[model samples]
Target chain A: MELLMAVSIGVLTACGIYLMLRARTFPVVMGLMMLGYAVNLFLFSMGRLATEAPAVIGRAETHADPLPQALVLTAIVIGFAMTAYVVILIIRGRKTLEHDYVDDRVNERDHGVAEQGLSKRAVAMPETPASAEADGEPRP
Target chain B: MSSHLLILPVLLPLLAGAVLLLFSGARLAWKRPINLAACVALLVVAVLLLLRATEGGAQVYVLGDWVAPFGIVLVLDRLSALMLVITAVLAIPVTLAMSAGTDRTGQNFHGLLQFQLMGLNGAFLTGDLFNLFVFFEILLIASYALLVFGGGRARVAASMHYVILNLFGSALFIIAVGLLYGVTGTLNMADMAVRIAALPAEDVALVRAAGLLLLVVFALKAALLPLGMWLPAAYASAAAPIAALFAIMSKVGLYAIFRVHGLLFGDMAGPLAGLGQSLVWWLALATMLLGILGVLGARDLRTLLAWQVIVSVGTLLAGWSLGTPEAWTAALFYMVHSTWMTAALFLIAGVVVARRGEARDSFMVDARIASPVVGLAFLAGAVALAGIPPLSGFVGKALLLQAAGFSGDMTIFWVLMLCSGLAGLLAFSRAGTSLFWRGPVAEVAAEQPPMPLMPALLLLVLSVLLVAGGGPILDYLAATADAMLQPADMIRAVLGDRYLPGGA
Candidate 1:
């Protein structure tokens, strides 16, 4: 069960990172939601693996670690609130800027916004001429 | 019964806020109740906490029957209570001065502010790491709303930067907590302190690394040097009262640094002893240099004051890094003093902005409407901030220098002092020339200022009183300083390890 949870977290993290790098505000928002899921699971798994166990004491067996479970519960609630807030903020930003793309306007203005979360490999290298032409950019 | 005072400090404002929320539509009526309750309750709490800290060493109040790591505990030690009291003392007047004349905001404003206070107090008093993070989020979320309460383009843009930075810090904090819990299997600060101390020499580095990661997050929150570019822009653009409230925020980070370094992870004899030397002290030196340059280069009064706050962070870090008992006292003393002084400075800038109706590039824009009282208040704040003798700032800096010692190797201390002195002269001289010496704004129609002179006068008087009473304050601080440096006191308090060998 712990391994499954860990695997799920890794999957969520990869998807989150991928979507977070997208140019639109919507994808970035979705990416944050995915990252929140991963964080929640990661936080929950820190107490180590316990299988076939309830969080409460029972006649047949002992309970799982109640502390981590409790922490995970709080994180879930806080995460939901944060996601709601970010969604609203994105909507507001879109309305104010009159654009749906996160990379528009503010990113162009701030300059650092685009560079903030990029992969080092992507940042270090410009696209090759064939790739640039394929992507419909100037080869030179 | 006295222990009950602890609950009241948190509960009173909370109750007041809830009541205010019910009257959200009442407009003008909401202001008086919120102002009065916030003022009285905070004053009472601040005084009571100080008195209790002086009389009884440190008291822990368990929320219910559960003990140890299971139940929540509110620990009221000298350091915790001192921070709480200072927060309250500054919070009340600033709140009153802010809400006095402004158009009524949403009734939720009072509730959010009080809730933020609750979170701050909780963060300081909490005995568990998870609880600390929980309260941090509470304060942060509420601060987000408060910072952008009355919407402006500048406010939103600046607040975006603020939120993103703090959110990143919070994420890092959570990750660090998860890693620490993985290793130790405990979240209680006291229990973790004991376990970490008992670890084998080889295993200690992981814990120290965890400590450093956590420190990095706090450093971000505290706006240390290079990490502080977000501060001046965000703070200078916010509403004055909100900016004033934020003066308390960085202290929470500093408080965490104090607690973790002095109590929980305080194996100063281990590999971590040099950690402060390389990380905190050097960072502090850089912070001072950058802060001075920023203050000098800043184009507006609000941003200039904001940059000064960054400078104060440097001062506090330098003092804390000294690690001597005397050094701790100086750092702690400077912490409280800077909070009030910065709040007052921001308030004065707000007043200046209101009168001129424009953000002036320098302090020297208009003079006729500048009230004598306001100028006097700014002068007092400037004098205190500059470390001029007979003011509170002088005492704080003097103690810091004494603590660091005047040995030739103390170049950091000397440079910081020299910069502060020069900055002090620059700040006051500019204000004097621009505010008092310059001609009045004869063209614009005059409007009566919203703030009652009473509150600003009260703050000025308090700043002066602190200056006069520095001798006794110094003595009291010295004792607390000694308590902080003595590893045995902290270990026993946190770990209950009296029977363990080498525990002392």
Candidate 2:
């Protein structure tokens, strides 16, 4: 049982690393989810696998260690929340930047949208031609 | 006050945040006062806790009247109290600055800030590893929302990377905790320490692996050399006040290293002694060098300040990795100074960016700053950050150098530290000249809005106070270090006298 659990963890981790190395945000998120699952499983297996054992103190001399079970449950919930957040963020990135690539250089072209938003709220001042020229675009 | 006063730092923020969330639709005027009042109260509580902690000994508060190893416990000592005080000090300026128009850009800013504080305080005080992870998640989630609070595409992109990296770190953290618990059968740090100390020789390998994993997780959080790729862009893109608050976030990782390593694995003859310290020492040197390079190569002021943050972390850890009482004392002093100085620099950068609309704090641009006062603030911050004499940074660096003098690799530390200081000086001078001196007069002469200068000024004043009160501050830090070096007292307080190896 321990061997099986360890092999399963190793496979999940390998797959997660492979996916995480991809250049796209969606795959990265998927990789993160896989890694999260691997970690949760690893945490659960830390108590060592137990079959037909009471979770609480009872007549049986052997009982499953419940602490890791409790910890893994908490980790799973936090991981779920984080995954949801990342998905929403990726969706927003896709809509605004029009791409899903994780590379910053690839996303640089769409920075004008971000800068325009910043200028609108942050500065509260009119734009100058010099700044526009710096952006390598004609003044709007 | 009862010993229960210790929990108020965490509970007050939790309650205030929940209340603020319920009143999210209330007018800013109404919510502002409440948030401000809460911050002031937090500061008072922090100060009180610091005073109480300084009176001597570790104070342990167990939940539900359960014994230490079985129940959740919060340990308040000088180090934790000092962290709380610094957090509270930073909170005041950040909360006030948020009120000055930054909060309106996002929903639930006040609530998130309070939640973030609760997480930070809890993380500082919690004695259980699992509880630490829980508080870390709370703080990271709140930080994620706060990072992108003032919506910008840059912030969104940066927050994405920040969230993903930290999520990975959190996973590793739990894995490490699980491995440790699997071996020790306990989650309370003090209990775990006692177990690990008494472990059989055959299990050393597993314990070492767990300890290494824990260090790797902390390195990621602390932004140490190879794992620090996410910090610069993420910090540069954050809103100023949030960025200021985050000055303490990386320190949280360092704090974990100090507390966990100092308490559990500090003994020179222990199984896991010096397991990862040598690696940490080299990594810290590399982090310092890379951070200085980043500071030099930065395109804008905020990014430069972000790199400066990394550099400061590297410096502190380099001293801390030596694992001496003097080194820890110096590192503690540096921690206090760096937190205040970096926060001030970020705030000043915001003001500079606001004043120079067309240039927007970009070193390549040539628009002059409108306010001389802002320029002077920037100059003071730059000087302090560069570790020039008479400021808090200089005092901290001097103490660090003196502490490093005791180690065998003293020359390497001195060379790297001095070279980094020189590199920072050159970079800041060049950036300063291009920014304030060489820039052309603006054609528009735009009127500066009433940007809240008070918070920035207050932070700068705090930096000055660090310098002016250096003697007393160093004395206090020495005492803090003395208490920290003797972690057995803390363990004894939490786990009772019987847990001590030879029992009293």
Candidate 3:
């Protein structure tokens, strides 16, 4: 049972990492979600596996670890809160910047320029004149 | 009485915040009155608890009347009670300095502040790992809201990064706790300590792995070197009062690191050998070097102060890693002094930003309004933060250096201590020149009201007094540090000495 759990976490982590490195915001979000799932499962498994058992000891007693279960439940709720928040933020990013890609270099550079007392407009150094035309092109 | 002391620190602020939330309508402004009362009450409780600890040893309060290894517990000893007092002293001033008319982020500003106090108090007192996670979440969520309170794009963007990094850290933290529980078959700290100690040397590697996870998670939270990327950006973008509050939040990370390292992991020291101390020392050195460079490069005054916080973290780690009574004394002194000065520095920055305008680094204040109060406040804060003599910061750093020197690891000690001190001084000097020395614009210079000098003055004086009256306080703190390093008192306070090797 422990071996199965370890294998499950390993696979979850690989998938999570792969998705996290994607170019788009949605995929990255999904990757983070996967990572969260993997983490929760991994943490829960630390309490050891219980077979056909209630955590409480009684007539039908096969003792299980309740602490990890309780903790993971809290994690799930917190994870949901975080996911919802990040998703909304991504949507806002798309609306304002008019791009769905997770490349926030444009925003970060602009902020840095602003902090340096330079004009944001002046700091908007286009990579290429052709890219400037591409910048106006709408994404699906 | 001792057991009851555990509930008061956390519960009082929570009740106040709840009431404030309920009475949000009308021009009541009840938050201030309630918060002030709660802070004073917390301070009193902390002092009484400290006294009680000195007289009677450690105090453990089990929640729901359940015994250890079964139910939740809150432990208060020299370390915790001392931290609680420092937290309260720092908090009350920030609470008083909060401007009611101000809109900090989108949340009900004062309500979240009180809730943060609740979380901080709880974190300091909790004896269980799961409860620690709960308090951490509470603190971070409230911090996120406070960080973005101004609705600025930068703050909002920074909040996103802060939230993500912390969520990742939390996931790591919980996983480590789960692993420890699985191996030890218990979540109670004292119970786990005994079980881990009983394990043979060959089987302790698993415990070390778990300990490493916890260390990483906490280092991230404390903004230690490699894992600290999110801090300066996030902290610099937040409002002043909120940033001040975060000064203490960062310390919570160190608090956990000390507890986990000294208590649970310390028992297994035989197997790990010098591995634990070495890991901490290496990290501390990296953190110190990186933080100083970061401060030197920081252009904005607030960002400079933010980097100073990271440097302070290095000092904390270095002191704790020394693993000696003298070193612990130094660490404790630094913790108390740093928390105060950091909070004051941030608040003073806020006063400057408020006068100069919202463009942050570029605002020009009117001489009339910014001259007397705000300018002097900034100057005092700058001097105190730089660890100039006759202030709490100087005394704290001196003790830290003394301890490091005592360890005879003089190379790391001299390099980190001198560099951190120089970086801190240069950062504050630049800020002071920009803020107080520079003349204000002609137009608003006439209209400017005298700066609110009282708060910063009070903070500086208190710091000075702490230094002046250091003899007794130093003795008390040193003894507390001695007690923490030994852990016999702590263990006895939790589970009696019957579980000890030579049963008392």
For TM-score, the strongest prediction is: 2
Model 3 chain B poorest ten-residue lDDT run: B442-451
Candidates in order, TM-scores: namely 0.88, 0.92, 0.89
**Candidate 1: TM-score?**
0.88
Which of the two, 2 or 3, has more lDDT? 2
Of all native A–B interface contacts, model 1 reproduces a fraction of 0.22
Q: Model 2, B118: alpha-carbon shift in Å?
A: 0.9
Model 2 has a DockQ score of: 0.54
Better of 2 and 3 by DockQ: 2
DockQ of candidate 3 relative to the true structure: 0.40
TM-score of chain A of each: 0.69, 0.74, 0.72
Candidate 2 chain B lDDT trough over 10 residues, lowest sum: B442-451
TM-score winner between candidates 1 and 2: 2
What are the Cα lDDT values of the candidates? 0.72, 0.85, 0.75
Model 2, range B88-134, lDDT digits (tens) per residue? 99999988888887787789989899999999999999999899999
Ten-residue region with minimum lDDT total, candidate 1 chain A:
A131-140
